[model samples]
Every structure is written in C-alpha cells, then in structure tokens.
Target: MRHTVTMSPDSLWGLPQIRAVCLMAFAGISSFAVMLAALPVWGVGHAVPAHLAGTITTVMLAATVLTQVVSPALMRRFSLRGLLVWGLVLLGLPAPLYLWATALPGLYAVSAVRGVGFGLLTVTAALAIQVAAPPGRQGEAIGLFGLAGAIPTMIGAAIGAGLTLSGNFGWVCVIAATPLLGLAAARGVTADGTAPGGAGESLPMRIALRRLVVPVVLLFAATAAGGAVITVVPLELTGSARAALVLLVFGAVTAYARWRIGRFTDRRGHRLVPQTLTVIGAAGMAVAGWGFAAASVPLLLAGAIGTGIAYGALQSVTLDLAFSRVPAGQAPIASATWNAFFDAGTATGAAVFAAVAAGSAGGAGSMLVGTGLFLLVGLATVRSALAPWLERRRGPGRMEP
Candidate 1:
C-alpha cells in the first residue's frame, strides 16, 4: 500500500512537502549549531568557570535526549504537528535571552527549553520525510535531509566559534535564532501527513520495544563510540588547529556517508550493509586507538574518516530499518526509540571512555574497547536482521530481487 503512494520522480528534493521540511530542518539545525558553538566560547571568554561553561551543552543535550525519549508517547493525545509548532516556538523564542544579563540559573533554564525544541524538531522532521516520501525513494529522501544537518555542522560551528572568540557574543544569539523563523513557513504545510500510533497505544509496549532491540542496540554501540570520539579526540590532539581539522574531516565524511547510504540502500537494500559498516567501524577504532597511542596525525585522520563512514551508514540503516519493521502509523515510536538510544549511548560513552581512558595506558585502550563494543553489536545485528538475508547473497542482493 505504501509503495503505491505517488511521488515525484526526483524522490528527494522534488516534492513540495519534502522541500518545505528540508528547508525548515536546515534552518533549525543551523540555529542550533551556530548558537551551540558560540555559547561556551562566550562564557569561557567572560571568565565563567570552565565547568559552568560546559554545563550549557551538557544540560541542553540531556534535555533534548529526555524529550526524545518521552515525546512520542505523548502523541497518543496530541498531534505531532502541534507538538512541533510548540517546539519551534520554544526553540526560537529563547534565542534573544543570550544577549540579556541573565543569571546562570536563568540561562540553564533557557537552554533546557531550547533543547526540548530541538528534540521535537529533529524527530518530527525525520518521520515526516519517511511519511511523505515517494515509494521506493525513502532512502534518497533521508539522504537529502541529511544534507540539511551536515551543511550546518560543517560551517556553523566555525562561524559561531569565530564570532564568539572575537567577543561578538550578541551577534551569535541573533544569528542562532534567525533560521528558526523558517518554522513559520513550514507551518503552512499539511498537518495530517502522518498516521497515528507513535505512543504504543496501538501496539503493546513489550512488543513494540522487543521489535526495536536490534537497531537500538546497534545504534547505542555506534553512538557511544561517536560520543567518546567527539569528547576525547580534541583533548588528545596536540594543537587546536589539528583538533578542528579532525572534527571537520569527521563531520564532512559522516555527512557524505549518510547521503551515500540512502543511494546504496535503494539499490542494494539494507541486508548486510549495516554489518559491513560496523566491521569497518571496528577497524577504524583500531586505527584511532593506534593513532592515540603513537600520537600519529595521519592515523588519526584515517580513523576519523573510517569511523565516520561506519557511523553514518549505521545511523541511516538502523533508523530506516526501524521504520520498515512497523506500520507507517508507528514511525514516531520508532524514531523516538532510535533517538533515545543514540542520545543515551553518546552520553554514556563519553563518561565511560573518560573514566577508563584516564587511568589506562592512554586513549588507545579506550578506543580498542570501543572496537570491541562495535564487534559485539555488529554480530548481534547480523544474527537478528541479516542472518536470513545473508543466506541470499549468492543471488542478487535485494531480498525482493
């Protein structure tokens, strides 16, 4: 039935609905990246305690993660569109607060609210793409959507950081809030684009949860490593420029891999793709660990590229598979589940890696542990989702074909 739904031949960027959602997503993410990048720098420059300066991000991310976990359940009684609208309001209205003389507590509160907005914006738009995309073109649509986030990540951080580093904090807030204005335009799109059932009222909680175990676990392992890398890599590198380069490379590669995953999946289907990427990720972890131990820049660069490839591929495959496992009506629940694992794993990974690496030989040991986690989860994913498909590799790759 879903395959029968008509869509433009271009699949990704052709339809009006997709274009609107992508445009809004690009702006929303840009707002987040630019402001998020600037805020801590501004705080640290103003002589705020390092711990306090850092808490801004930690608090916001935690809040965002929490919302991702809870919002889908609330959809039983509320409309997804309504929630998204409120979320946008929360996200956008708080931007100007940065220019004010708010106390630490006040700032923290604002950050929390904005985090909720970001969470809603992210999950809603993701599901919308799946719901509205043309038949046989979901992967391509997601890949195009990935561009919205990727572009901002590549440049927003630099602009935000450069601005705040130069003591132009006021402009950071203004710029950060500007993209959110696009939300108003997005509101004119259809509200009834999705079916209902994200909250588990339509399906038993146990069943819904059990169906998600494979993707959730895989995402958890992958994102855990991702979080650790983001948190520790910069600290391990010798210079700020080197650290920036590593992150930039990681982000660019990740975005490209995400875009490519869709195209690959459209042609190949998911079958062994996630497993393959996980193996590559494990090797990348090995490279990263070795680089950390030897302090080798080239190894680090290679590791970032490899790890990013796996990260993006895994992310796309898991979420896409999650939606495929259930009815279209339940996409929101799947989205929430996928995001919860992603957010929780990231936070947990950073903390655990920091703890273990601090007392061990060096970052290398922690990275090796990351590799171990990926191997474990990758095997689980194969057994759970790909085992039957794996047997069909003797033929053409697609399960249908």
Candidate 2:
C-alpha cells in the first residue's frame, strides 16, 4: 500500500491552493453575513409578519441543504474555480431582488437563489481546502477556512446593521459587492491537476446516518442557543442597536476563538481543543444564563463572547473529525454531510427556542435554559465523542501524519 505524504507547514502555507481556500472563505462567509444582517431590515420595511421571519431563514437553509446534496456532483463536472466564480455571480446577482420584494413568496424566492449559490460556494470551498491541506493538518486547514467567514461575518454584520439603522436598503447592494470580489478571487485559484475522485459512488444513507448522529445532536444543541439569540433576543430587547451590539460581540469573539483553535488543532490535536472549549463554553453559558436572568449588560456581553468562541470552534472541529475518518477523495461529501447537521441544528434550535420564548418563558428564561443545555449535555457529549479519536491520534503506532 502506497501512503500519501503530508506537506510540511511551510509548504502548506506556500501553496497557491491554500491561498485560494482562504480567499473563498472570505468571500463566501462575507456574503452570508451580509444577508443575515439585511434580513431583519427587509422584513420590517416590507411589513413582513413577525411570525414568518423565521420561515424566510428556513427557506434559505432548506435551499442550501437541497443544493448541497448535488454539490459534489457539480464539482466533479466543473473546476473549483468555475464553480466558485459561478456561485459568486449567482450570489451577487440576487440581492437587487430584495428591493422589489413585496411579498413573502418573492422574498423566499430570493433567499432560495442565494442559498443555492451559497451551497455551491460552501462545497467547492471545502473541496479546495482538502486538496490544499497537508495530511494530518486537515483540522487546522478547515479551521482557517472557517475564519474566512468568521472575520467577514463580524465586520459585515456590523456594517449591515449600521446601514439598516439608517433605514436604507442600499447597503444590501454594498453587501452584494463582496461576492463579486470573491468572484475575482476565485478566478485567481488555479484548478489543482487532480480530478474529482469517487465519482459515482453514492454515500450510503445508513453509514452517513451512523456517522452523523452524535455530531449532529451536539451541533444542534449549540445552534439552538444561537437561534434563541437571533430570534428571541432581538424581539425581547428594547433596542435594535443594543441587540446588534450583542450579535457583533458574539461574532467577533467567535472568530478570534476559531483562529486560535485552528492553530492549536494544527499543532496539538482536535480532542483537547474541544475538551477545553466545552469547559469554557459551559462556564460561558452559565454566565450568560445568569446575565439573562439578572438583565445585566456586562454579563450578557461576556457570555456572548464565550459562546461565540465555543460555537466557532465546534463546527471546525467536527468537520476535521469527520474528514479524518473518511478517504481524502470523499472529503467534500463528508464536509457537506457535516454542514447538514449544522443547518439542521440551526433550524431545530430556532424552532425549539422560539417555542420556549413564546410560551411565557421570557426571553431571559428561554436563553438561560437553552444555553444551559449547551453547557451541560451538548458540551459533555461532544467531549466524550472526541476522546477515542484523540487517543487514536496520539497512540505510538497511529501518528497524525
């Protein structure tokens, strides 16, 4: 059996493929961040029913899932650069539609189009990172890829929210511009000489199911915490500025944590990262819960920072673990499957938390309970699942490279 060799850190960083991966991350994540920021504004400007706002987000997520199912096949047919550029174009062209969207159906259609574009961007970017990364460094590579969005998400959300506060939809156009920039970045990425592998083999539904269950459950719990924040927190708070500040702080802290953890995972391993993060996350949730209960602004901000860090690292770690178990050729599918869990978690979290908040469990009570769940069952299970994998990576005969 011929083993593939891993690249040294220096070589990995020098590769154009790696640079491409970072660019795609920046572009893809920024686009989504802008959309998230603009959605609430569009909802209010158009008199969108409050109850239906969640549904709009659901539409985009649903479309993303549907498109992701076929993304691997699409990559097989097109070069990464081709897929990325087209995806960016698709993502960019749809924002103007928001200006004319007068009804729920139109808004949902816009979201669906953007979602499809996002789906394409995500899968291609995942594949790009896999091809670019050194063996044994997949965790770090993916973590860095995640930072692309994390940074832009923090910046774009702040800008979008600021523009929305001005009661202007023109900022949506500005947000769309980032995707075009991404298109230019995508063009610079040379297609790796390697062709797509595992062209015709379908991912067994049973196996994908078995592999995904635990990770999905944990991710769902965490995202539910996010959903509660995105949905219930804004509505419950008296001012949009304060609410936006909360979200901004959350994004910033999360991005920083992800960067640190990615570098840590590259050197240390995935297990320790998650274990440490989970403990910290648990404490953060406790603080957040306390803050919510007491309505303390300082405590709330601190909690948001902690939760953001944990959440950002969680997704990247999960993706690294999934890829570690799968063949290199199957990394894209593994990533897509992993992301599906994330999307499901987001949806489930939003739905469950919304119910709690609506039920007279005030927003504070709902957040406390939801975040508390993350600290307890969610973080605990994630740490437990990662233990065996960590042990294997450390064993004498099972060196990471």
RMSD of each: 4.5, 4.1
- Tens digits of per-residue lDDT, candidate 1, 42-125, equal 555556553355456566768888898887766555655666666677777788887763456766788788888888877887
Name every residue pair that clashes in candidate 2: 224-349
lDDT of 2 by residue, 1-401 (tens): 01334436474456677777688668766877766646755675688765555566677877877888887677767788887777787777787777787588888898889888877777777778877777666766777777776888777665665566566667656676577776656655776433357755545657655665555555566666665565555544556677678778988887876666655665656444555566666666667667767877788789787778777887677666666655556666776777666666666555556556556666666666765676665545654655566776787333221
The C-alpha stretches of model 1 lying farther than 4 A from their native spots are 1-8, 34-56, 76-79, 95-108, 157-175, 198-202, 354-362, 389-401
Q: After superposition, how far is residue 400 of candidate 2 from its true place, in Å?
A: 11
TM per candidate comes to 0.82, 0.85
- The segments of candidate 2 whose C-alpha lies over 4 angstroms from its true place after superposition are 1-13, 192-195, 199-205, 350-355, 375-401
